[model samples]
Each structure stands twice: as C-alpha cells, then as structure tokens.
Target: MSDLLARHRAVMPNWLALYYDEPIEIVSGKGNRVVDASGKSYLDFFAGILTNMIGYDVPEVREAVERQLATGVVHTSTLYLMRGQIELAEKIARLSGIPDAKVFFTNSGTEANETALLLATYARRSDQVLAMRQSYHGRSFGAVGVTSNRAWKNSSLSPLNVHFLHGADRHLTPFRGMSDADYVAACVEDLRHVLSTVVGGDVATLIAEPIQGVGGFTMPPDGLFAAYREVLDAEGVLFISDEVQTGWGRTGSAFFGIQNHGVTPDMMTFAKGLGNGFAVGGVVARGDLMDGLHAVGLSTFGGNPVSMAAANATLDYVLDHDLQANAARTGALIVDGLREAAPRLPIVGDVRGKGLMFALDLVDPATGAPAPALAARFMEETRKAGLLAGKGGLYGNVLRMAPPLTLTVEEAAEGLGIIVDALETVNAEVTS
Candidate 1:
C-alpha cells in the first residue's frame, strides 16, 4: 500500500471497503478519466459509484457551485427559503409523476430513504415494510432494516418490521430458467402470498430499487414491479422506488428506472448522480403523504444553496444535452459488444443490465460456481490496464460498469476492449 493508503487505513473504519489490494488515491479527474497520486491515468468506468453523472470537471456544475461560493452563504437551515433550493425542488417535482408531488431534500440517499420511510409509516400508521431479496438501500439503521443482503446488514436490530421479497435477482432465484412471463407471474404470486399470510395487516410500503445496485446490478423481469403495484393497490401498501443508483437517465432507456417497470411509485428517493458528486438527495411524494407528517422536521445541510445549485446545473446539462438519448444509444452498443465478447471469455457466466448500468458475473468455467477470487484478480488486472470498474454481489463475483452518460461510442469501445483484454489475461493466469 502507498503512504496515503496506509494513512487512510490507520484512521478510517475497518468496515469501510476500498477497491484493490493497494488502493490508488485519485488526485485529479477530467472528462471520463482520473489520475492517481502516481500520475497514472485510468479510465473511470464506475464514475464514483455512478454519482458523477455528467463527468469529472463538468463546467456547468463547477460554475454553479463556484457562483454559489461567491455568494458567501454556504448554508442556512431549511427554515429559510433559498431560490436555488426552490428551483431544484420544482424541477424534481415536475419530473416526478406522483400527483401533486412535493420534494423534501436530504444530504444523501440514506437520509432520503429514511425520510421516505418516516413519511410512509406516519401516513399508514404501520412499521411493517416489504423489501426485495438481494437488495441494498443505504447504511443507516433504518435503511439496513430493509436491506436484505447479509454482507451489508451489519446488525439484526431494526426500527421497522421489514420483510424480504423475491424476484429482483434472477441468478439467485430457482426460477431463473423460466421464461420471462412465467418468471414474473411466479414472483407476483409469491409477493401476494407474502402480503396475505406473512403480514396480514397494514404494510406501510413496499420499497425496492429498480435495479439492485450493490446486489450485482441485478434486475427483475420487465413489468414485475407493475404486477406488484397492482397488489400494492389492493393491499393499500404504498410503493417507494429507491432510485439512488438508477435515476437521472443512467438506465439508458428511462429517466427513472421505475419507468421501465411501467408503474409510478407513491414516493421516490434519489441520490447518486443527481448532483453530479455534490451531496444531494431527496424524496418526492404525493401531497397527502408528504403532508401527513405532523411532527416538525428540518434538515441541517439538506438543500443548502451549494448542493441545490449543483443539482440545478447538473439537471440542466442532462436535459439540454438529451443525455438520456445518448445513454440509450451508446449503452446499447456497450451491451451488445459485451454480449458478443462474453462467448469468447471463459470466466464470464452472464452479462445483464440496461443503458450504462451493466454487470458481468464471473464463474468457474468448468463447474459454473461463482468465482469471487477470480473477480478480485480481474479487478486488479483491469486497473493495471488503466480502467476502473466496480465489483458487487452477495458473492462478490459481479463486475459492474456504469460510465457517464456522456461517454461516446469511441470511449465505450476503448473501455470494452480494455475489459476484454483484462478478462483474457486473467483467464490465462487462472487456468495456467
């Protein structure tokens, strides 16, 4: 490890995960790349966990934050109305399909999910919630309660009575071999049975990520959530889409990942890319649900002027450039390229995802077992090849790639080539 990495390990929590055996401290970034302390450039495929939506050093976002800094009012609590905050909220409300929507800002996805859960429980007067298996929301106690992943759930103690559901992850399910229509039907049946038999009472809400981010970029069959929405309507359970990883057109086909499911959520929480790396997150809810919280609440740093300005400028760039269209176009190319290349690679078992959000599951070529060690080796090799990707899964065998929406076809091809080369190199070494 380098000196900086040693310093980081000495002071930081041991539980805090870092990529690579010897973590490289990135000191500078440009459009689609970052330079480490050693002055080595690496193509940034993960884009800071998909937070840098536009790319590094985006002029609009930087200028907006710079302008806010010049104003000299860094923060004033939610008691004061700031123009940037109001404007950003309006933009979010317009984008959110919930009827008479209202926006409550937070400092991160964890807080956004926390606020949504609070609104949900208060509105329905129930602490019971439904969540998906292999799902991860945030690290907070409340968020962890609903998170079903064993690796991320550090504690069994939870504030809410959370139940895990099935169907989000095809790989982990016994029904993976079934056709899409049959698979969705099976999962929907399970959800209904769970609601009727397990809880049998008021379930405040069913919260799910459109694409299970940390659960290895796993996705359910299309229209699965829509089927669940029908059940939620009958059972009087609200729906919350945790779009922290899938929002702002990152999914390539939809501006919001829930759109692909063909159902509008009662409430939605977003973070990650909205502010393009600035600390910003929020919950958008229907008017009644939002107003149901009788207790007074205020976020200290939520929707502060700087974050609001950053979000405003970022959203403007996203909309003006029609980055969603680009995501669909180039994302299709990347997916097709990966699918075509997977046949030639021995370790790759699956390639799945939408738009820019894609994942490759590594497995033992002979036995078809998850190869997490191979995944780790490949990650280091990818870094050495000057490309940065992310790894996830309950088994830690999935390679995730979600480059900025602004990635050109040329960049996509270049990065995918590097990935293919890394896979080939690792395959040779592992087999040798």
Candidate 2:
C-alpha cells in the first residue's frame, strides 16, 4: 500500500468503513472509464452510485462549469433571484412534466429529501412518515429516520414513526405473473391494507423510490404507484417520491420515478444525476404544498448560480441527445445479456431493474440462499480486473450495475464480461 493509503487508514474516522479500500488511486475519468495514478484504465459501471448520468468528464458539463467560472458568479443566497437559477428551475419543471411545480434547490440528495420531508410534514401537520423496508432514502438525520436499513440506522437511533411496506411482493407480482387487471387490483388491495392497518391516518407522507435502487433494484409491481396514490389520496397524506438515485434519466425516464408507474407524486426529490456529478439537488412539490412552506423554508446555498448553470447544461444535453432513450436501449441489451448468461451460472438467483440501473442477486448453488460473501468476492475480483461495480441490498448480495447513460453498448458488454469472469472465479473457489 502507498503511504497515502497507510496514513488514511491510521487517521481516518471509523465511519468511513462503509466503503471498501482499493489499491489503485484513481486520478481521472472520462466517459465510462477511470484511470488510476499509474495510467491503468478501468471501466466504471457504478457511475459514483448512479450519480454520473452523463458519464465522467463530459465536455458539455465541463464547458458549462468553465462558463460559470468565467462569469465570476458562483454562489448566491435564495433571497435574491438569479438568471441561471431561474432558467434551471424552469427547465427542470418543464422536463418533469409538472410545469406549475415549485422547486427548492439543495447541494445534495440528503438535503433535497430532508426538504421534502419537512414540507410534507408541514403540509399535513402530521408527525409520522411511512417508508418501505429495505428502501434507502438518504443518510442524513431526517431522511435516515425514514430509511428501514438497520445497519444504516445503527448509530443514530432517532425516533421516527415509519411503517414498512412489502415492495414488489412476488405473491402480488404485477405484470410478472398475473393479468394487468389482477395485478393492479392486488396492488390496490395491498396499499389499502397498509394504509388502514399499518400506517393508519397518523402518516403525513408516504415516501418511496420508484425502482427501489438501494433496496436491490427491485421494481415495484405494475400499477403499484397508482394504488399507493389512491390510498394516500383517501388519507389526505402527501405522496413523496425519493428519486435520488433513480431520477435524471438513469431509469430511462425523463423525470420522477412515479412517472414510470403512471402516477404523479405530490412532492419529488432529485439529486444523483441532476447536475451530472456536480453538487446539486432539488425538492419539487405541488403548488399547494410549496405555497404552504414558503414562509418558513430557507436554504442559503440552494439554487446558486454555478450549480444552476451546470444543471441547465445537463438538462439540455440529456434532452437534445435523447440520453433517456439511449439508456432504455443500452439497458435492455445489458439485461438481455445477463439473462442469457444466468443459466450458465448456478449462483445467479435473480436479475431486475430498468434503464441503466440493474442488479444481479448472487445465491448459493446448493441451498439457493443469498450469498453475500460471494458478492463481495465478485466485487473485489472485478475491481482487480479493471471494472468498478457496486453491491446493494440489506445483505449486500446484489451486484449493482448503474453505468452512465452515455455508456456505449461495447462498454456495457466489457463491464458485464468482467462481472461474469469475476463470478466464475468466486464460484470456482467456493466449489474447490
């Protein structure tokens, strides 16, 4: 190990234990590839946890940043209106299909989610929020309260009235097994039961990730969002969709995750791909809810000029280049390839996701149980072999592949090949 690594290990706080230590020191990135200090190139499938929608070091994004620098105006308080912020807000509202929606910008996903939660709580004047089990909203205090992952909540045992809902339950699998009508009905019934029995009327907002990105990339059953909307509507609870990971065309969609289920959420939080790796996030809410919080809500760094300019450029590039469609097409190819390869590997349990976000569940060949250790080994081996993939799920058994939307088919294939090779190596070692 280098002296830098040794020093980091000795002095860094223990909270950084969540990430694995790699030998290589990545110095630069471009498109879907990253280069280490020694000029070794690696395919980056993780895309910084699905934040880099336009890939690394895109010329457009870089140019936008440079132009903002040239203007000598980077940061400004929301007390004064700025042209860049205004344009970016307008663009986001237009692209989100919610023209009248009001937006509150932030510097990160957690902040955006926190803003959404505060707005939701204020709007309904309720203390409780309902979130799904295995779902990850963010790591901040307010957002962490709603997250169901036990490991993430271990340190801060903050009090929160959060009810867990079973997501994409195979028993009620919509579009996977039953007819569309039956699937939709089952989902509706499930939501109704959760609302009346589990959450009741105490819930102020029901937050959900459209595709459950960190929760194993689990796609909710068809019409599930519509069902949840109905339940929330009946209870007069705000529906907040946390699109921190699944937004910004990463899921092959133009806007929020709720759109995939053909339902509109009362409030939406976006961050990951909003500025294409730049520090930017937003909380978009319905006109009524937004108006309710206008008096109390304030963020000093939100909607700054530089971040807004970057976001504007990102939105333009995404739309003009049809990156969402590209994600849809490339993602289909990757999923099909994985399906074709799954039969050859007995440990391959399941494959799920959409657009550029996908996951592969590793299992024990003999017992068909989740093999988290094997997944860890696969990540290590793949990283050694020049690919960067991530692990998700409560057990960390899901291999998460969320490459940038700009990733080409050839790059996707190369990344998948690395994964296949790593899986085979781990499986062989286990059998031996």
Candidate 3:
C-alpha cells in the first residue's frame, strides 16, 4: 500500500471510500489538469465531482478570494449585515427564475436541502416526502433519509416519512426501453399514485436532483419534472429541485437542469459549482415558503464573506463569459465521441448525460449486466493513462465524467482519446 493510503486508513473511517486501487494523491491543479504527489499530471475529467465549475487556479476566482482575504475579516456570522452575501444572493435570486425568490446560504448542498426541508415541512405541515428512486441528496442525517440509493443509506432510521418514487434510474428500471414520452408518463403516474395512496395527507415536498448526481448521472426524460410539478401543485405539495451537481450551466441546455423540463421549482438548492471550490451552498425559494420557518436559527459559517466573494466572482465569471453556452458546445464533443465509441467498445452498455455532465454504464458484454469489477479495472487503466475520472451508479458500475465547463475542443479530444484507450485496455484484459 502507498504510505499515504496506509496513513489515511489508520486515521479515516473505513466507510469513507477512495477512488482507484492505488489512489493518486492530488497535490495541485491548474485549468483542467491536476498533479499528484508523485508529480504526475493528469487531465482532471471529474473536476472534483463538478465543484470546480470554471477551472482550477482560476485567476478571477482566486483574485476575488484574495481580495476578501486582505479584508482580514472573513467570518462575521449571519447576525450582521453582509454586503458580499446580499450581492451574491441578489444575483442568484434574479437567475433562479422564481418570482420573489429569497436566498438562504448554507455551508454545503446538504445543509441547503435541509433548510429547504425545514421551510417546506413547516409551510405544508407534514413529514411525508416524495424522493426519487436511485437518488443521493447528501450524507447528513436528514439527507441520508431521503436518499433512495440503498448504498448511500447507512442508517435504518429516518425523521421524515420518505416515499421513494420511480423513474430516475432509467437503465435499472423495467421502463428502461420505453420512449421518452412513455417513460415520463409512467413516472408521472407513479407520482400521482403515491400522492393519492401512500401519503394520504399532505406531503411536505417532493425533493429530487434535476439529474440524479451520485446515482450515476441518471437522467430522466425532459418534461419529467414538469409533470411531477403539475401533480404536486394540485395537491399543494412543493417541488424542490436539488441542483447540487446540475447547477451553474453545467447541463449546457439550461442554467438549472430543471429549466430543461420547462418547470420552475418552488425551491431550488444549489452548491457544487456555485462557489467554484469555495464552500458555498444555498436554496432559493418562494417568499412565503422561505419566511414560513418559525424557528429562530443562524448558520455561523453559512454566509462567510470570503465564500460569498468567491461565489460572486464565480457567478460573474460564469455569466460574463457565457459558460452555459460553452458547456453546451464542449459537452457535445465529449458526448458525441462517447456515443460514437460505445458501439466499438464492448463493456460500454450505455452513454447517457447532457451538457458537461454525463456517464458511461460499464457492463458484462455477454450478459449485459452491471459490471462493477470491470468499472474498477477501467478506472485503474485510466489512472495509468493519466486521465482522472469519476465512478458512481446504484450498482457502482458506471464511469461518470463532468469535466470543467471551460474544457477546450482539443482538451476534449485528448480526454476522449485517453478514455477510449483505457476502455480498450480494460476490455482486452477482461475478454482475454
């Protein structure tokens, strides 16, 4: 074992997972590439699970944070008036698409979702919630309960009466082969049935990832949430779009992934890319729902000035530079390349994603079943080829890629070449 791995294992919890058979210790990064402790550089395809929205060592983001650092006061608590926080919130509110949208900052996506839950439950006055099957909101106590992915649920107990909904994981579902319209219809029907029977009384809200992030980039058909929103609207259940991974123009087609479906969520929680690696997460909600939380509480680190500065700069960069259009154009190159190569590569069962976010379902070619072992081997091969990627899925058999939005066409080609080579190498080893 590597010395660092041995040290990590001795101190860290065994359940805290690490990627790769021999994990590479990243030491530094710039643009879309990172260098390991051993001084080996790699094309960072995952971009820290889509958190580095723009890129690493970004001058704009760095300068903003540096300017805040020079101010000497970083944490003033949410009790005081903060210019940075309010300005960032204003930008987010305008872009949120929710009329009279109010912003609440948190330290992470999990907290943002939790705060949204608190407001939602209080507003609707119920503990019942509708969560998507194969979803992963976060790892916190409240988050774990609503996470429908079995692997992510460490605890047997939950605070909310969570009812799992179908249609998120299209590949695993019986309706996998269904057309987009049919799949959307089936999912909508499931939502209607659950609301009418399972909950019985009022459901606080239906929280869902716009594109199920930790669930292996599982994407439901367009208009899926639109139908869900329609059903929930009639029942007075709020719709919360968890845009932790799919926010910040990452989806290419829209600012938030829910926008693609033509539905503006009652509440939208975002984090990952918004801060561009600074700790920033928040929820934008309708005025009534946001103000409905009766308890007097404050998040000490929720709106740290430094973080707010980073987020403001990041958002400004994203908007001024038009990263959304960039995501769409660049993401297409990777998606098209992967789709084109899927037929030639035997282990590749499916290529699914939109914009900068997408995934490759690795499987046993003969059986067409999820091949977790093969996925592991494929990751190792990519590491050897100096391409850092991501792995996830309900079955742990998918290779996910959400590179920085600023990935150049040439960089995309280079990454694709490395990916194809790695896949080929892994395929040969398995089939041999």
Candidate 4:
C-alpha cells in the first residue's frame, strides 16, 4: 500500500463514510477501464455512480480542456460573461427543445438540486416540497430535506416542510394488486392526498426522479407522470424533475428523463453525466419560473469556462456519436442477458433499468426478501474478479450496473460474466 493510503486511513474518520470503499486505489482511467495504483485494470461498470457517460479521458474533452486552459481559466462571478459559458447554455437549451428555458449551473448535483428547491420555494412563497418515497435526491441541506431515504439522513436532521409520497415502494402495498394503469392512478391519487393532508396549500413544488435511480432502479408505472402533472398544474404547484442520475442519454433518451414519459416539468435538475465526469451540474426551468429567479441565486464555480467547455464537448459527442441510440441498443442486450441468467441463479430477484443504467436486485432465496449482505458480498467478490460494480436501493440489495455509455458490447458481456460468477460464489457460500 502507498504511504498516502496508510495516512488516509489513519487520519480519516470512518464515521463519515458514504460508499463501501474497495482496497484498491484507482490511479488512472481510459475509456471503460480503470487502473489501480498497482497497475491492475478493472472493467469499470460503476462509472463514478453513473456520472461518466462519455467514459474517461476522451480526446475531444481533453482537447477542449486544453484549449480552455491555453486561454486562461475563466472564473465564475456575477461580474462577467464567458464565451464558453454562453455556448454551453445555448447548446443545452437547444438540445432540450425548450425554446425559452434558462440554465443555472453548479459544480455538483446537490448544489443544482439545492438551487431548484430554493427557486421553487421562493418563487411560490411556500415551504412544503413533496418528494416520492425511496427516492435519492442528493445530500445537501435543502436537497437532503427533500430526499426520501432516512438512512442517508444520518444525524443532521432539521425541521423542514418536506412531504413524502409512496411511489417507489408502492409495489409493497395496495399497488401490488392493481394493474399498471390503476397503479399509476393510485400513485397520483396518493400524491394529491399527500398534498392535501400533509403539504396543503404550503406546497410549492413536487420533485421526483423519472426513474428512481438509487431507490432500487424503480420504474414508475406509465401515466403516473401525466396524472401527477395534471394534479400539479391544477394546484399551481411547481413540478421539478431531478434528473441528476438519469439525464444526458443515460435513459437512452435525449435531454431530460421526463421527455420519455411524454410530460414536461416546471424545473429540471441535471448532473452526473452532464460534463461526463468533469464535475458540472445545472438546473433548467420553464420560462415563467426562470424569469422569477433571474437575480436570486448564484454560485462561484457554477458555469466556469472550463466546465462549460467540457459540457459542450460532451453534448456534442453524445449527439454527433449518436450515443443515446447506442445506449438503448446496448442496454437491451445487457438486460436480456441478465433475464436469461436470472432463472439459473436463486439469489437473483429482479432486473430493472433503462439504457446504460440498470440494477439487479438480489433477494433471499428462502423468504424472497431483499438481501443486502448478499449484495455486498457479491460486489466484493466481483471487484476481486476485476469488475467494478456499485450497490444501491433503500435496502442496498440492488447491484447498480451503470457503466459508461461508451462501453462496448464485449465489455458489457465480460462485466456480466463477472457478476454471474459472483452470484455463483455467493450461492455456494450460502448453501455451504
């Protein structure tokens, strides 16, 4: 181990942990592969929690950064305008197909979400913000207030008028007996009930991830959004779609994830894949909503020239290379492979995802309950076998396989093989 690694473990507080850190220290990356300090390579299926859509160190992105550096890095301030920032804003707006929408950039997903929450609340002059249960919206003060996961909240709890709707966990209740259409209708009704009972007129906005990424890759039944939109519109509540984990071609779609469901939101937050690993995030809002927040919020490094340049390059690459369509094609292949292998593995419970973002839920073979320990063991075993995977879900039983959009078909197959091997090992251990 490196001296720095030893120093880190000695000095760092283990209580502040987030992820289950692997022993290997990643030193470098190229395309879909990451190399550790010891020079061992691992096929990167994690993709920095689904942030690196374009893979690592793409020449075009590197060239763009180099060109920006040559011209001197542009700092973000309220005082000036940078060309790169303007270009990226325009490009994103055009691609989003929202002719009058405006963009406010941030350095990370949490900040972008914080901005959206602030704007939604301030504009509507209400304190209540409704979010779906089992959703993972970042972990900042305001973002954490809206996030549905209590486990992630830790001890930093505060008083906030945040309401929860039972959308993602609906499968566990009366929703399980309903058809898809009826389930969605019931979800929308629940949203309305939450607003009426808990939120009331104080409700300023309702935010949700179109596809619950960290909440076990839960897919909302069709017509749910349309129903929710109708209710929000009627009640004059702002609808904010947190697309931090699903935007920018991850869902095999263009722009925001809501587009796939055939409904638009009053505000949309994006990060993760936006800069393709270069640390960029932003909030796009409807024209009316945006016009109200023109001078209220600001960030120092929100839309700096270098970050904007990286975002522009990423957007261009996604479109010019047709990566969105590729995600659909490749994602289908991987999902089908998992389905075919599911029956052979007793630990496998469910497979659900869209595009490059997918999850395989592991369950106890006997009780059919979520098996978080088994999932963690599988992740460790997979990493040992040179495949990098992530664990998600409220129970932490969903093996999140959100690789880079640039992952080739062969690479997907190879990564899946490691997962299969890990499952076999886990099953054997349980049996023994």
Q: Indicate which candidate wins on lDDT.
A: 1
Model 4, residue 372: distance off in Å is: 1.1
**How many clashes show up per model?**
0, 0, 0, 0
lDDT of 2 by residue, 1-432 (tens): 478777887898766654445556779998889998888788988877887778788888889889989978777688887888888877767656664798889999888888888888888777688887677888887878888877677545544567767665452324457765666676667667877786645678888888877777877765777877877787787888888888877777545567888887888888877788788998888877778865756678888787887788888898888888888888888888888888888888898778888999998989887899888888889878999888878777889888888889898788778877887888788766
* Cα misplacement distance, residue 380 of candidate 3 (Å): 0.8
TM-score of 1: 0.98
Ranking by lDDT: 1, 3, 4, 2
Output the worst ten-in-a-row residue range by lDDT, candidate 3. Answer: 167-176
Residue ranges of candidate 1 with Cα displaced over 4 Å: none
The CA lDDT at 37 in model 3 is 90
Q: RMSD per prediction, one decimal? A: 1.0, 2.6, 1.2, 2.0
RMSD of 3: 1.2
Distance from true position, residue 108, model 4, in Å? 0.9
Residue pairs in candidate 3 whose N, alpha carbon or C atoms collide under 3 angstroms: none
lDDT of 4: 0.81
What's the lDDT for residue 75 in model 3? 81
**What does candidate 3's lDDT look like per residue over 139-169, in tens digits?**
9988998998889889968888999998776
Weakest 10 consecutive residues of candidate 2 by summed lDDT:
167-176
lDDT of 4 by residue, 1-432 (tens): 557657777889766544444467789999999998888899998888888788898999989988988887656564587777788877777666664888888889888888888889888888887888888777777777877876777544643588788667754957666787778777887887786676556679888998887787887865577788888888888888888888878778555678877887878898888787788998888766777865655677888788888888988898898888888878888888888888978889888788888889899988888999999899789878988888878888899888888888888788778878888899888766
